[model samples]
Target: MTLPDHGGLSGPEEIARFIDDPLTSSVLTSMADICLVLSPEGRIKAVSSKKGSPVTGVVAGWKDKVLSELIDSMSTEKMRKRVDQLAKDAASPEVSPPRWVELLHMLGQGETLPVRYALHLLHDKRHVLMLGQDQRPTIEMQQMLLNAQIALERDHEAQREIDTRYRLLMDFTSDSIILVSVGSGLIVDINHNAALMLARTRGDLLGKSLADYFADHTRDSLVAGLEKPVQVGSAAMMEVEIKSSQRRLQLSGKMFRASGEQLAIIRLSDPGAGVVADERLTSNLRQLFNHGSDAIVFSDRDGNILAASETFLNLTDVPSASAVRGRSLAEFLARGAVDLRVLLENARRAGQLRMYATKLNTDFGAQVGVEISATWLDDQFDPVLALVLRNASSAGAVRPDTGSGQDQNMQGVIELVGSSTLKDIVSETTDVIEKICIETALELTRNNRVAAAEMLGLSRQSLYVKLRKYDLVSKDEG
Candidate 1:
């Protein structure tokens, strides 16, 4: 029987055959999957498989069979079900768009491995055209692409969780936290503690610049990334003079990186709590020594006084708060304040407060302190002393003899404290602390520094500066 040309409605095989280009025909013939075209009345039109299929070879012989017997019984179950679905879909008055399914399909010698299939129905929905491709490689490529996408999503999710945890810790942590944009000095973030420390609400702190808090020197140093020395206490605060209502506090902190900003976490401390004025002036060394019995004084280990005992106060008629806060002990020589030298030298030789007598013309008149004693506390060059000046003069009266070493009232006192030098003791004590880390490491550390510079993530040069600041050098075995 002769066939209708049907315009461009030819099947895939027929189209491949009509192509005069040998290269394209050769390529398409090697791999393709197709279905037989049947008219609405159930007559065969053309078989659409590529050239090598045995099924395509038998299409003309099955022209008289009903649609139910058309597919071979030995065909794969997947093919049989697909053919049945297509035939049933054709008989319907109207059918929905076929799902765009891509199946694995092979070429001439292999099984159908991958085929991207799409069925397009005419406006009447009675006739269907199936388009397919040998899509095995394409399907594998797509699956691999999908797997990579899933892995990337998982990694992104994990990173997001870590970022969230870090933010939460910074926000709710107890330590004062301030986030400054490293370049601009703009206060990008401030936690509740930092806000409170600044005496500003978090809202007030958010946009305000760091200049709001820094003093002239400190501010300039910070901008220049230069190190500035700061005192870290509250009682007798190292006052930072302010120009206006803005208060500048001398505080110390470490520079660190956070949230893309180089900021500082300055932990502030209260100076000794409720310490009296005299107690405040006394260097930290004095009170720790002599079990609180020995009267303490802060003077330059060179005898420049920073503080003096209540007895020293009474002996000199100096009020604890006023008369002798910053004045060096030598400044009172005109006021009959006894030279603390002889006793200090004796204490240095003895390592502890040693009893000695001295006749001195103090405010209480020329007096003899029979049990006078003095001792250096530590070897860090701090002005610290332990003294027990005994008022051995006539009760409430001046000493009878105020002349010389042969003075009649001068009493011989026993130097009961031992005879080791103060420096020797401090040197030995520091050695004990330095032994845990290597001597080189300790010398490479600072401020009675940690076990080692490397352990603290600090360079030896930094540690060296700190040791020098604390007056600790190779002499300090510690």
Candidate 2:
């Protein structure tokens, strides 16, 4: 199969023979999705489509149909104009090349197809050939791009809203706050209050070294302190004199990370503005309660814990102070409600109670001997009780001798002579000794029945039975 020389086809017969060949139809179908031959009257003479093409089934019944009838109403005018132009070009003595036109074809069933077509005047000049390429794939890609642009705009708007709120909060706060870059030690941001305190505008403070406002002697230490890690509740604090005013100020700083960079948030306050003689003393007392070896607790008048120190949490085998807050303090006492009642009553009468002995029950089921000092704080609005507990187990060896009661009981048991039957006398002596031993064990263990039972070589069940017989267990314990 060979094509004719590029010079020209030999004659009209040869050209007509080539157009009617099967290979010509295959070549035309390969170049476009749909091909149509129309008569000079604008009726379709024939239609052809590529094998397996989507448009093949759509145009299968289009043969002999008028071109305008197959297209949308809007495209009918366009078709008429293009056909008239082609006729004019064909009639002119000067030869004109085929021209491409785009049209929308109605496929019925609420569907439409877009196609680009080129019209060629045949050698006979009585029929027109139309070649069309589908435009649906390109249209779909453009729609996807439009949707993506809309989503990106919405996300950007949301981020801007959040940034605006954060700026408002920082500007309106009463406390003096400053943000500094950790690496450069330069001010990154300053609030309205901080600028006023420094006697400068916010714009002047930003991008300046934070240490420039402090005395020369303290600059190095202040910058170094801010670079270190700070715990959540405890920030590093220092006192320094301002360079301009010569007035002393307290500075505290906390380190945080933002936007992949380390930053420090610093707070500044005047040391003398709200000074009270007892304020320093109160701060010292608070420090002692937090870091002291003794466990301390503050509770409401009803015995529910309001606050507890770290030492108290450790003593009770609890993880954090928040776990014990708002819970009854008696839950950790060995004698439970009995011990709490005594402490409250004595402290209320005497204003304070000292050396109140008890046992602490740990979460792990162990008991520890402790001596508590309780004070009743009667404030006008809110009254509370403060308790300090110290471990007494190590001091057991140095405890003063107080066994006079046991000695008296033993003496009475010995005085039981042979006046009654021997068996009766022996039985009476056993009761006195048993009662004395129970009392001694209870005193040694700080009234912890579990500890007292282990000390007396008895099971917890047996200890309970004996305690019931001797009427020693409190009603709460029972």
Positional deviation of 198 in candidate 1, in angstroms? 1.6
Q: What TM-score does prediction 1 earn?
A: 0.36
What does the lDDT read for residue 277 in candidate 2?
A: 62
Which candidate wins on lDDT?
Answer: 2
User: Per-residue CA lDDT of candidate 1, range 302-401, in tens?
Assistant: 6766666665666666656356776665444432232454445546766665444344345545443545556677757554765555556547634343
Compose the digit string of candidate 2's lDDT tens values, residues 1-478. 1112222112223223425765665677677777877788888777766555667667766777898888887788888788889889988999788878888988888788888899887777778778888878778788988888888889889989998987898888878899988777789999998888888999999999888888853446776776553664678787767788887888888878989998889999986776786799899999998999999999988899999998888888988888999999889988787677767766776788877767899888988888899999988788899999988767552434347876786677677665677787788778777877787667644577776676567999998898888777883164
- TM-scores for all predictions: 0.36, 0.46
Candidate 2, residue 379: Cα displacement in angstroms equals 17
How many Å off is the CA of 323 in candidate 2? 27
